[model samples]
Target: MKAYAVLVPGLAASAPADADVRAFTETYEYSTQPEGTTSVQLWHTARRVTWDEDYAEEFEHRIEIKHGVSEHWDVATSTVLVQSGRNGLTLDRVVLGPRYRFADRAEWPVDVTLALEAGKVADRSIYPLELRVVAARDIDSLTLAANGIVGVQVGADVIDEVDLAIGWAAGASYQLHNKLRIGAETWGGTADEGPRPPTDGVNASVGPVVHVAPSSKLWVTGTAGFGLTDNADVVAV
Candidate 1:
């Protein structure tokens, strides 16, 4: 589940305009808030896993605050809370990131954005760094987007070498009404101590998604994802 709330008015003060069209729950689009505007987003995710004869559940809650510094640049920070099995909910990590768009919509064949983020996890010496290339294209009422992601784990604790991960996310959505859009998305990734084949230690999922904007100030999005590999969770929402 995902919810977006606009706290400040900018170029437009209406639904679908006030907030970017969030077509996929896991994939991000190439749109930024107008300069001087601010927005808040809340996200919740649940996963179920089975190991031997035991079943465990995990929950994650995230809150993000974003501010636009210019037409093409924006910065955001996120706090994550996590709960696993019978453990109590606790702070897990905090991440800070900045995103910059290369050109305005329709200025090029596809709009592109560069995003970089750093995160610190609780009680862990290893820190996480991520870089993503976001690309999207709009054709009438239909939109297509994709993201290429790379991540690294660095810290004093790493013995031999740092860990590396790579992934990709893609989605397509079509506006059915002024306040509603329907879409589908797929994402997968693999990680190890260094570069390796994509089939190694890989997990993947595919899902259908929906976005609804009931009012000018609020927007909601949801997705039902199913695992495609044995290493992935059975289902996620």
Candidate 2:
């Protein structure tokens, strides 16, 4: 039996809403589940302030569903079905994509994955593609893992906002046990909206993550992150 873990941390920022007003601003990471398995995730995020001089608190509730297409392939979808505070409680966009893992070949020390995502953002549609590399080395009683991601945003909405937008996410983790692991992850990106790459400045967060496997059919994860830069949310717990 095999299991899939959501070890990748999400990129936090603002997402465009209806009327091209940039109404709601925020974000995350999408990882695939294990083969022959179905997973449902409930994730939440909270913010008190931002870099735009807006002093408002925001909270978001996201629901994600993942199904393994094969041993090395997965299809997943996530939706911000509920939200509150600054963004208000409303249905947000839904993103669906497939992720493929290059685990059969051992030529490279790092495991690689390519993913493509597209869906609705408010009333607009978007297509974002990413490539992820996972590097891991196991030591006595502990396992260390490193991950890096790079991608671009494409769609009618994105074209209206910038010529080309790129984003990246990187993080590392330590496995304390087969069912529990702890780590710190930082993710940020840039687009054509500003001077160049990392245009709006980089937003970073440090935090602890926990994963529990209560049974072969279920796995649970919880994470809390504190903002490390002015561009990030004050606290996401």
Candidate 3:
């Protein structure tokens, strides 16, 4: 028997601050990384195609923030949480205000996000303002997901619309040891245009997730993958 190197990214999903992005062409769907720090990650996969090993690779770096603590309330009568703060949910950052959790939890867990486009990184490209409305449901062995986003470029009239970024990924994980698990997972996403659609693009990934929980509050993860099609990137920049 032979042992192989397995990737381990611990229980980061439990409290990842900015973990929902399935609702647009620009946001990422799911990541096992936690909030309040930055991480650079790379992944690759090799497949035996035509008796030869073909390979694909991807890499990405992300900065995440879990800014505030939210209080949840229950309102069974009207089915809405009484506003405890000023934030409300909308795709345009249409409004930048506090949001209150309904007294009772909605059928799904919800998070509202607003990307302030107050500055530009470059002179040629104007970073657009994006608003995200995301909801997710997780069960014992399966997870459910859906999201919607509205993107607006400051000066570009060509980009503005109510777009739903929707997709799902599922797999049952098995622990092979006290600190390692092996399993296959996959997800797909597309930008469905509303009246004004964002730039058209497709994002999806399929491979394995190495799950580990090292201590009470620390875990690390790595994902390696190969694109099923040549159209996918050798390195997703």
Candidate 4:
């Protein structure tokens, strides 16, 4: 008879991960657009975790806001709440991060970004620092992108190493119309701990993604992931 606290992130599916790109595992999009740009997005994520041999469910609601400080700098903030079988409803985590894009920003076929994030959950705080690289090329009506991600975490009750995670994501999308696109993405991450291989405790998932833009300023995106590893949650939507 044991229990674990489920922690979820407060971020939109389109939240930027790097200079430019979006994947199921992470976003490689730039931190800032142009100097006077701002946007907000609301997202919902449902996750199911297996406890012992049984299943437990959790739901998260996230509200994220981003503001561009300059052409190469942008800041983002998010707040999230989770409802779980054991905790009922409670604050999950709050995250604030800044991103810096190098070279030609999002238009570069290969772009790089440095991001720093701090999160607070309960009485514990964690900071994650990451370097993300994105390479994308357009082939006719289709776009293909690949991302390489590496990050480290430090804080109380968390890992304090320099290389805590190594992950990658690949995406292919077809533009069906002026306002719509459909794609599939796969992402995987491995934790660096103990003597196991880099992917020993890996959490891997893959699913389809859709993006819709009804107007210039409004966008809607959704994706679902099915776990491919025993360590991963069964399903996420």
Model number with the top lDDT = 1
Candidate scoring better on TM-score of 1 and 4: 1
Give a tens-digit lDDT track for model 2, residues 143-167: 3444455656567777554334345
Q: Model 4 Cα RMSD, Å?
A: 7.5
Q: Candidate 2, clashing residue pairs?
A: 10-29, 13-26, 14-25, 14-26, 15-25, 15-26
How would you encode candidate 3's per-residue C-alpha lDDT over 1-237 as one tens digit per residue? 011211223423344433321211222232222332222222222222122223222112222222223333111101111111233422221122222333232343543222222223233243344444434443443433343545445543324343234444444355566455455554444543112233455545556555554543333444443334332232221
Q: Which ten residues in a row have the lowest lDDT in candidate 4?
A: 1-10
What stretches of model 3 exceed 4 Å from their correct place?
1-59, 72-120, 129-135, 141-183, 187-203, 235-237
Candidate 1: residue 87 Cα off by (Å): 2.4
Candidate 1 segments exceeding 4 Å error: 8-18, 51-53, 192-199
lDDT against the true structure, each candidate:
0.79, 0.51, 0.33, 0.62
Off by over 4 Å in 2: 1-32, 50-54, 86-88, 105-108, 125-141, 159-163, 191-199
Model 4 scores a C-alpha lDDT of 0.62
Error of 3 at 9 (Å): 21
C-alpha RMSD for every candidate: 3.7, 10.3, 13.9, 7.5
